[model samples]
Target: MSILVISPHMDDETLGAGGTILKYTDAGEKVYWLNISNTKEEYGYSEELCRKREKRYYEVIRRLHITDAVDFKLQPAHLEKYDTGEIINKIGNIVDRIKPEIIITTSPGDVHSDHKTVFSWAKAFSKSFRNPWLKKFLLMEIVSETDFALPMGSFIPNYFVDISDFLEDKIEALKIYEGEMGEHPFPRSVKNIKALAVNRGTIAGTKYAEAFMLLRCIEK
Candidate 1:
């Protein structure tokens, strides 16, 4: 099977589904790692910092032996102009090219601006295209460091996948976002991910699992 994972930023795919990607790869399936934004930003970097961090992100990915990784090289914040239709078309192009059996992406209530935008665009692209290979669209949470990530007022989970077997890999992947995280004080960061895994595992009949809000499924 072929799969496409849409990440808002470089580390998102890993933070959200690195273990699942590992699972798929172990099962001998092709997986595409696509990030919608560029790694550089003039505002956040002092020329050298950007260069250094960019190099490290790739180094980490390569070190992890990730097979397919695409930055898309889009502007840092996704749109200089902020046109939703343009976002849709761009994502549709990727979907058309990948024609994946499974599509994984960020969630709508994620609170992160880029995360929300990616969710909107992925939903639009999925509906706009009629790819028969597209059977499942899964939403994985990233940077669930806020109250919005919890079982909030309206957010509900549709399913969860056990990642206990790959929790160590998830921590390693989150480390790839080195510059941004920079020694987070909140133990809840990785702690929450693991905790969620255990909690979800109980519900899903596994030792540890990741939660997802499934958007589309063609059949059971």
Candidate 2:
């Protein structure tokens, strides 16, 4: 199976779908990562920070065993500044090239503007009639962003994947993003990630799990 994960930033994937991704790759499936936004050095971010972020990105991908990845390098926190149609067309081109069986992406209801923009373009490009090869469309939950969304756009997951065996691997991969994780109260902390996983697991009757909103699925 071919799985494509669309992330708004470098660490979003690891925070959201890391364990499930590890499970798929462990089963010999092809997993591709498409990151839509980045912290560009020219965006007033220090060169040192950009370099550090890039290095952490490589380390995370290496640990996840994902060999196929693409970074669009668009400026972070300003994805909406780009033309929606242009972004959708660019993403569509990648979809046409990969022809993935499943696509997991950031949620439209996420609190972060970048996440919402990524979801918008990703959803536009993955319409069933436009891409029959894409059998499943799922929206992953990112801590610190998805949880903080307004009640009207709150994430209500209808799908769950047990990541009990791979939970540790997921946490380890996320650890590479040293700048992202923080203390116990921080939403992106490792403790809370595990807590959320366990909570989702309880709903799915597993020891640890990742939750997603199943936007669509087609069985052949």
Candidate 3:
């Protein structure tokens, strides 16, 4: 079955679900990527810088062998006005068009306003589905914020897809976002990926991994 992955920024998918994507691809599932916020934001970037981030995003996808995709309309970061009407309609159209069995999105536990908006919009869109028979819905994590935030006593992971083979692919995909990594929030390099995965693995009892907040599982 085909799967749809929605990302707020360009590299987010890789930063979050690169391993998961690789696992699915290896299992012979087609992946459709929807990147919704490749925009020029003067508030946090110069025009050139914004373009660089967008280009880096493109590089990451290509490196992952994700050739068929759509980088849609520019949704503003943080203050992105959720056009529930438009987004709901558009997402329904996509669902109708692609008919994915699964949807993967950026997690809501994220502090990034743009990431949060992306998930919320995705939820609104998923509502319009003509087929609630959709098999799976999951929110993937980027930046490892959720792992840190979940208390040591009460953390719960609903699904675990081992990424041992594709770990390097995840790193290669992440290297595309050079500008943001060295600046703020994160170092944005392949190095941190190992550390992040290691930490997540420590919690989940694996060597390295990517975690997803599993949302829904429809009966097949």
Q: For this target, which candidate reaches the highest TM-score against the unseen true structure?
A: 2
* Root mean square deviation (Cα) for candidate 2: 0.9
Q: Is candidate 2 or candidate 3 better by lDDT?
A: 2
Q: What C-alpha lDDT, on a 0 to 100 scale, does residue 112 get in candidate 1?
A: 69
Q: Write the per-residue lDDT of candidate 3 for residues 153-172, one digit (tens) a residue.
A: 22256776678788987876
lDDT tens digits, residue span 172-194, model 2: 99889886789899998888999
Clashes (backbone N, CA, C under 3 Å), per candidate, total 4, 0, 2
Better model by lDDT, 1 or 3? Answer: 3
Task: Order the candidate numbers by lDDT, best to worst.
Answer: 2, 3, 1
Regions of model 3 farther than 4 Å from truth: 41-47, 50-54, 125-129, 144-156, 183-189, 202-205
Error of 2 at 168 (Å): 0.5
What does candidate 2 score on TM?
A: 0.97
- What local lDDT score does residue 113 receive in model 1, on the 0 to 100 scale? 71
C-alpha lDDT of all candidate models, in order: 0.71, 0.91, 0.72
Off by over 4 Å in 1: 41-44, 63-65, 75-80, 145-153, 179-188
